[model samples]
Target: MIGPTMTPEILARITAARAARDLSDLARQAVGTTAETISPAERIKRARRMRQMVNAYLDTVVVAEALAGADWSEITEALGRREPDTVEGEYADAVAEWSDAAEAEADAAADVEELDAWYARHREDHDPDLEKPVADLLNRH
Candidate 1:
């Protein structure tokens, strides 16, 4: 219980599959969008950004879920691999690594929030006029 519930091999497969699916979806969307609306270069850039965002979100969710609680036996059974005990060590190591990473990400997010709050407090010095437009664009998304 100290580490992740799924073995590293299983986790890797799941992660790869998810990433592939996300990238494929992004590619499909990019292909579907009108080239006149957005240039091919911009579309590629946006697709990369979208993929990164998706992966980041997925990482957070997976880490959180692992930390909350996962049934190792069930996962192992689903994977049709070794017994739970056989992969417990690998799972624990993966969990510990992810926990540390999650903590670091949380700290970084807090720092970003702090900086954003500071910028908000001193909006005049920062591009106060563009704030509305930026907010509008973000909201539209």
Candidate 2:
């Protein structure tokens, strides 16, 4: 079945994530003391770098799982279930921004006019008066 393919860089991402996953120990070394001993500045510096590692770990795991033939719709559903709790307005704004970026990326990557025209023609053949515009390029949660 057609689905998302792993990019060439995915292997590198996997490797980097593997390394990043173990950085807590290295971070301990760099800090050279317990959290209580460190100045607030040092703590924040460690926090920022560790945050990147966590992000990499999450990104690689999700992308690797999806590329390894997992059901993408299921993955999406799982991710949605894991979304952070947020205020109503924050959630709405995030959704809107996600929607806008998705549409923008699709438009950037393809000839929108020709693509929509193709969709129109195909749908017309399949269902005469029921023809409609193509659905969103990237499915958003």
| True lDDT of residue 72, candidate 1 | 64
Clashes of 2: 0
Q: Pick the candidate with the highest TM-score.
A: 2
RMSD for each of the candidates:
13.5, 17.5
Q: TM-score of model 2 relative to the true fold?
A: 0.40
TM-score per model over all chains? 0.34, 0.40
lDDT of 1 by residue, 47-88 (tens): 688868676645544443455566667556654766877645
Give Cα distance to truth, residue 127, candidate 1, Å: 30
Clash-forming residue pairs, model 1: none
State the lDDT of candidate 2 residue by residue for 1-141, as single tens digits: 112332322332333333543564557566666637768997779779777877666655555454444555565666674433332232344333433343333332344234345546444344544332222321110
